[model samples]
Target chain A: MLDAHLRLSSLAHLGLAARSIEEAGDAGIALGEVPRRVALTLRGDGEDAAFLDAVGRALGTAPPLTANTVASLEDVVILWLGPDEWLVNAPAAREDALQALRSALGDLHHAVADVTESRTVLRLSGASARDLLAQGCSLDFHPSVFQPGMCAGSHLALTHVTIHQIAEDPVYEIHVHRSFADYLWRWLEAASEPYGLAVVTG
Target chain B: MLLITCPWCGVREEHEFACGGEAHIVRPLDSHTLDDAEWADYVFMRRNPKGVQYERWVHNDGCRRWFNMARHTVSHEILAIYKVGEPKPEFEG
Candidate 1:
């Protein structure tokens, strides 16, 4: 386990060190097959109700999920990426799912992107997750402001990253690209040292 | 090297912006009428004019929006920049 920990570089080796955006099942936190076509979608232009309803049906859930909780619309999960933009991360294995959305919602004016190799999700848990984040970011990540079901995107360590507080257990998943993963991980670990951050590995 | 003043992140080097070929090449939504050659031309052809040229740039590392820039290809100087929806305001200073 220590060897695995040591493999994570500490020196800031900037330039494509992280993995691309990934999607997996909620049941398996920090473990799942990385989707091939991770859609970074833009849904601000059209009606979200029909699209959300369709996703809710596919995911075995109901529409109109209240804010402050993670919701699934189908294979694509509604992660509050920002105020107006929600990342619709559909797994590549579900090509039919993507096709269904495109075919049925042609009038929606949503932009779907295939960004599998461009981003990676790093699972940050242990007790020190929040402390590590506070050190590098300007956001007031108080428990009430940034807790479970809260997802925020901003600049971290000179790179663009979106940090999602996934669970009440304080398991926050950090997303960065393959190019920025190493630098971010190292920065995270170093920032977490004071609070004793244990690198969670599979 | 030319420097760009990002409306969001402030002034920085030109390395942050990725050249997006044309400044305003509107894509034809009705592709049924476009011939194969015409489509290819629109896709592949780039106007790398010498000076005072209007070009497209994407703030990949910053705001992540498409914007226009009036850049001199020869000297690598950006004369102006504007957002995608707004028109290029006349150069004031």
Candidate 2:
């Protein structure tokens, strides 16, 4: 019964968010660089094939941002949050791409909000990660089927989450509202201390 | 074991959900023409399906949304699972 008091740490002031990007600045974890990336809203026109094609072309076959490679963009990335949406990850320096996308999809009933500070990203690794996750989550994560490249959305400890399994290192990426990040982080940390959680940040 | 795919969350355990019953029971277009007994039959009667059946399920612990699935009670095999609002997909097979 290893129970450490749970503490919710909010990175409300952290400027930007990087989703599960591997390389980020000094903030530790995948902290998005403040004022770094821009969000383009695409509403009235729906998914502009021409715009997407243009973005795809701008990235020049090798998209600067790591595309999800699953359901949405190139099936590599998916908009799990809503219908007619896509999560486009650009390279480390993609300010230009954002502007290009915006101009390309100009005024079609779309509104993009900069959510860099709206959420926090936590990378939970180590074998015990799954054990710790089992404490509150209701999904069957046994490796037999939930292997790498698979992602699932569910409520863990009553908080909505997007869980992505990146490796057998059993590395997990947790994305939640910035306000709830602290609660979930503390909850996971408390559950993983004994299994030797290697807190990751960069 | 049988795997149930959620429209939003993907596949999950069966225990996390509750069986929601059939997806295709239709009521009469002109209900005024039917007697009270006939109305009750349409509203309360349930067909104890023993073979292939279309059922509804609420992934209470998962997506928390209702969905329809086609399964066989005898074999315990789920043929398909779809959103509750959409029309039942045409059985292609």
Candidate 3:
């Protein structure tokens, strides 16, 4: 029996630790959870220079103004969710960044929300990652269109998700609600069965 | 399936959007002077036109932005898509 007081990731109950993961072999698809990351939903005027400057000072990188794009600095990534909304993601240890954002954006007409516990991220990568995602998503994932640094909000297997492509190797980080993490993971596993799914831990 | 284009998120599947009935229905300026019947008409009545129609749509799953759309009822053709607060484009047919 698992300890009741132990902290667990969203996918921890799926027993990924016991599953065999191919780290060196040529698995068609690799799946893993990016656990314990801080997610903040940020809203502000994209056209306001002061708002942009304040956020840039807080995160060391200005939020991407262009739709369906992402801006990254060191370990923090800001994904454009709308014309005036963005999702800021950073490591769990970077709570100082959150404080900096709140302090810097003071008196500005903006909203900052800590949504870390509300959502979980799944990393899907490898040669067959695009193909597997294409089966369930309507967005065009062709190499020319959805390259590195691009992000989009779409539904996969009927679950809402914000997908960010972080690497040219076609690695995609799917941000989904914590409650739907298991359902999406199972769906991905089923969808990648033909291509052979390899589960990894990070 | 209709391919609707979001003002901010570009083109996306129709399932990601929700139609909010007719657009450009202005409320009466003097609401206190209006009778119950007048208020009911403003709140309930919709054009429900048979030909070209202007309507509001929200990108529910994608960017969650609300915008306006012009579509033909019979042909199911989308004529134009514009952002909120923009002037409605003149359409003949």
TM-scores, each model vs. reference: 0.52, 0.54, 0.96
**Candidate 2: misplaced stretches above 4 Å?**
A1-9, A12-52, A58-83, A90-93, A106-113, B1-4, B7-9, B13-80, B83-93
What lDDT tens digits, residue by residue, belong to model 2 across residues A134-177? 88787777998666656655667778776767678676766666
Error of 2 at B43 (Å): 16
Name the top lDDT candidate: 3
Q: Judged by lDDT against the true structure, how good is candidate 1?
A: 0.57
Q: lDDT for every model?
A: 0.57, 0.56, 0.90
DockQ values, each candidate: 0.05, 0.17, 0.89
Worst 10 residues of 3 chain B by lDDT: B44-53
Model 3, docking class: high
Candidate 3 segments exceeding 4 Å error: A1-7, A20-24
Chain A of candidate 2 compared with the true chain A, TM-score: 0.62
Q: Which interface RMSD does candidate 2 score?
A: 5.1
Q: By summed lDDT, which 10 consecutive residues of candidate 1 chain A come out lowest?
A: A24-33
Residues A1-202 of candidate 1 have per-residue lDDT tens digits of 1232343322224322243224322322232112233545434432467765654554444222333234564455556442234565566555555556566556665655545456777766555556667677654567876677666555576667766676776777666776777677677656655665433231
Query: For residue A195, what is the lDDT in candidate 3?
Result: 88
- Show the colliding residue pairs in model 3: none
Better candidate number, 1 or 2, judged by lDDT = 1
Ranking by DockQ: 3, 2, 1
Choose the strongest candidate by TM-score: 3
